[model samples]
Target: MGWARQKQQHHNAAFFWRYLLMASALCLVFFTPLCRAGAENHRNAYATMMYMGTPRDYEFYVAIRVLLKSLAALHVDADLVVIASVDVPARWVRALEKEDGAKVVRVENMDNPYKKQANFDKRFKLTLNKLYAWSLVDYDRVVMLDADNLFLRKTDELFQCGQFCAVFINPCIFHTGLFVLQPSMTVFKDMVHELEIGRENADGADQGFISSYFPELLGQPLFHPPANGTRLEGTYRLPLGYQMDASYYYLKLRWSIPCGPNSVITFPGAPWLKPWYWWSWPVLPLGIQWHEVRRQTLGYSSEMAVVLIQCAIYIGIIGMTRLARPSLSKLCYRRSDKSTYLVQNCLKLVAFWCILAAYIAPFFTIPHTVHPLLGWSLYLLGSFALCSIAVNAFLLPILPVLVPWFGIIGVLLVMAFPWYRDGVVRALCVFAYSFCCAPFLSAAVSKIMVALQLTFEREAFLPRLGESNPPSGFNKLY
Candidate 1:
């Protein structure tokens, strides 16, 4: 009985082993294609890191590290190319080495001696002449990124849009903040040769040179996305979040409320580094204030106030032009003839009305309003005053020839209190206060007062003029 039981156990054990082998084979057959597919996908994914130099400052290094970390989080395998005069720090190299899939290549001896004086070199680390030369290094596609830039999202999709010699779209070409460039050693060499020979010195920067020459090289293959796509036609530009318009906020006192988080921000002239007085505080604070108020009031009163103020200013300036028309015409032209004065006044009125019509048409036609009412009103008023001054200057030759010195004064005042300048707010406030204190504040009030004064002047002066006008001959004198 013991021998029979042992033999039966051995037979069962062999059957169980055979069943396990068959199941293992079946599992491999089912999963092999999936494994292969995954491997193939891994092979297809390509990524790269490109930096011009080892950033000299801590902030820039931190930004680069942040960019790299973001790239890694997206499962992209990247190779870092550093174009620098000095070697990368040992610690940075070690840290990057420990990173699973990062490689760093140092390209030496490319520093520009004129970097400090040359804006192009200071910004791009290369002159227009040398850009093509440096671009000759080997890679499938290279992304040139400024050291200070931070990448918040995966850019792998940028690669999916087929390769071009170079691809970028901004208000201007050669943003260089972030751009994808295809590999071309020959083009790079040619660009370098051109740079060395000063072939691109006239336009001022490598960007200008590239813009001028890229069309010829690429034969319409180079892509330049427009600022507004519907107004143009091409690939939808990189989401606004991808490139923030930093200039409006940082450098200029212009504010824009982005529609969404993904809106690309582009800083012009490094606004974070240099903030503008008018735009820096007012826009951010006002935006926050409006956001809070919007929730409670369900209305944009502040914005409306700003727009109304702007409109009021515009209307006031137009009124001022009408009030000052006679004096301006007399001062602009020396001709005493009523016919000449009438023609000059008509021309001035037509010009002013045309400007007004053009300015107001946009507000009614498109709902795309940026400034609040008060702000817009102020802008229009200031614009009208300035335009009136300009038109008067142009007409001064034909009419009442005042001392040219007044035109210079006008120019200085316009410059000192320019609509776009930081000082404009104070100027506008002063003007508004003056207008409020005027004896005849409204147009009707002013016109009535002027008419009464004119009636009194005519009664007092007409009898003397009639009695005195008696000289004979063609020239009758009063």
Candidate 2:
């Protein structure tokens, strides 16, 4: 009888376990879809950047596209957006949508009501369009960005920040290059209203306006995301890592931000120094990382054809000048003594102008957005070609004529040295180098003048280029 009772107890326990397993499986099957649907309904965050139609439109377009692609490569769990003015080209807009996987939001150009303010910069006129970030109420949060930002890693966790947050890269003010904010129509409308009223803006730009709008951001406690995945409320100061200025890294040549993820690097110094400009590299070593992402993504197609054409033209110029040098050397200018002085002065003027053109022409010939090595090479090649024209035309010595080119190279090498202890030291060294080079440059000019005077005295019967001048008289030459 006792054995029979034991068997019954074991059978009852097995029956209980079987029902529990069946119930658990049923709950999972029924509840999983509901949980997923709720998640789908929740508003997503976006990684947003902006573009304005300005003289540098194409440059900014390339910059924003590169930033979007870099963010996409990180697989950040947020939508990528670009707030472009309506004047942006349709082809550019399409490229952003189809090629880069970014949603382009078209906004009207915002008028800077503070334009009449003293010290106002015209470049900041349309920057007021940045206020449109608050108007994107469909997204729960948005990380507003400038195209110059370089992201080192994913920063999706920034979405968990408060209603407004920015990094105080400066001691007394926060940098707006990369900032997190909750999107709200009410806030956006109020901002527009404030602009209409001509609010007091120190810098007459979005940076000043936004800073004024959130005055207490400086005093707020530093933000740390909650472990429970809860988003914070009110304004907060972000850690130095999120918007690390590229200048900061130059001091140590390494990132040492102790708080937050050292993710984004901002180029806030000068427009020309933005990482997208090929020449910005080596000067800012981090620019290489930006270009690597660009090469992987965009691959320089927009400017390549133009770059190739310029290269071919420069090569032809160089070759033609070299081939004709002997013929060119025999050609000379001569005139009667009465007008020889006037002729000599006019010829000297023309020669100086040609030399100046040689130094200036290459800057405008090369495509503005090529790779650094390519851009610098094209520039030097073009300069050499242009200088050759002046050299053969005026019969000047080669080394003195190439002084400006050598000076440019010297400056680049000094700026790109990479071992400065701090930016102040780097700046001082550059200043000292420039001061030292001034005398050499002045001497080069003097040598050029002396060479020009010698050419003026050379006697010739047949004038191929221009009318010849006597030893102390006037004669014009072409």
lDDT winner among the candidates? 2
Per-residue lDDT of candidate 2, residues 1-478 (tens digit): 9999999999999999999999999999999899976644345555555555467877888888888888888877777888888888899889989998887889888888888888998888888888999988888889999888888888887788899999999999998888999999899999999999887789999999999999999999998888888888888999998889888787777788897888888889888788878778777777777888888877898888988898899899889888886323343445445455566677778888988898788877777778887888888888888899888877889888888889888888888787777666877888998999898889988998888777654534233234343433224454
Estimate the TM-score of every prediction.
0.40, 0.82
- Residue range with the least summed lDDT across 10 consecutive positions in model 2: 461-470
Each model's lDDT comes to: 0.42, 0.81
RMSD of each: 19.9, 8.0
Native-to-model Cα distance after best TM-score fit, residue 350 in candidate 1, in Å: 63
> How many clashing pairs in candidate 2?
14
Candidate 2: stretches off by over 4 Å? 1-42, 47-51, 326-338, 418-446, 461-478
Candidate 1 on 1-478: residue-level lDDT in tens? Answer: 9999999999999999999999999989999989875643331222223333423343333334444554555555345443322355656655554642344554554444334444544545443323532353555555555543434355554443333333233534535455455546776777666556655442355556656555443333333333343222222233344555454443344544342233233334533331111222233322222222223322333235556565666577667755665332222212234543355446555544543454444344221222233333344345445455433423322111222223323433443342454434544544664555343224433443344334323423122222343223313322
